[model samples]
Target: MTEPPFELEPIGEVRTPFETSDEAPRQGLEGEEPTHGEIVLAPAFEPGLEGIEDGETVDVLWIADEADRSVLRVRDGERGVFSTRSPHRPNPICVTTCRVRAVDGRRLAVSGVDMLDGSPVVDLKAPLE
Candidate 1:
């Protein structure tokens, strides 16, 4: 197999209450209340958070480090990995849309998180128009 063309370095990490996959919701909005979390960006990436206002929605791209990367089918074996939101794929890069509750220096307070604590955040972007 050919090697990947590039490498990904985490610019930050997601801080959530979930310590294990079982503790996390399947989706960000799955629970009765939107899960709250924080994106703690590295000092070098702090400047990139400029102009990101409170109440704005953004896409957070992160690595599912705890995912089972060898699986290509859903747990029920009824659908292919690509056809489902299953994190158990060749590359466990995941994205979730979250609302910014607050922004303080290198930390962003957000809601609608499904990720576990300390998940490496690859990038953050405004939702595509």
Candidate 2:
């Protein structure tokens, strides 16, 4: 049976210092220092931020808009796309856990972000402990 199509509307956008994939760390906390970024939620979604607080960890789901969606393998074909964390996949969705540094209105100051600047934030939720 064919599956129905679905669409995702971004609840927010992330602001980071990395402009390109090469500039971003492979993982959120892999660099020498944890990178800081901000998630600016749309005014309509601000109400959903009620319970989140500083020091909490959240799972951030975002789209790798600049990634090559056609890449099916990496590392000289040593691994399939599904076996790796390559951003270049059929669906370039990426997930990372970030610490909530602060929350001011609709903007969340977070650390440990590895996404590129201006990445669309699909969703954010508390990670399973």
Candidate 3:
């Protein structure tokens, strides 16, 4: 028998100008004008914000909560979810790297965001060199 799925809680949410999914850019840093956004960390996760500052680039990992998780293939072929950047996936975990414009308390201001407003953030990591 398979083990029960693990529960993953959101650490925060992305605040962006894109109110609807269609309004968001398909990819960060490309195919759209420069955009700005903020990551609002939950009170309990505030400590995780330490060391994050301006001029740094971070990879924001988030859950595409509105995506259709049932989608197993896309692009009019039998392409697996892992082969595409399609949000509709089995897990819907997405990543976008943005440059930090500022950091205030628990809020991180960033640029080149492609995520929709109110996207639940799962984690943050420094981009690989």
TM-score of candidate 3 relative to the true fold: 0.91
Ranking by lDDT: 2, 1, 3
Clash count list over all predictions: 0, 0, 0
Q: What is the TM-score of each candidate against the true structure?
A: 0.92, 0.94, 0.91
lDDT agreement with native, every candidate: 0.92, 0.92, 0.89
Better model by TM-score: candidate 1 vs candidate 3: 1
Candidate with the larger lDDT of 1 and 3: 1
In model 3, the runs with Cα more than 4 Å from the true position are 1-3
Best by TM-score: 2
lDDT of 3 by residue, 1-129 (tens): 266696779999999999888888987666557689999999999898889889989999998999999998898867877888998998899999888999988899999788989999999999999
Report the C-alpha displacement of residue 55, candidate 3, in angstroms: 1.0
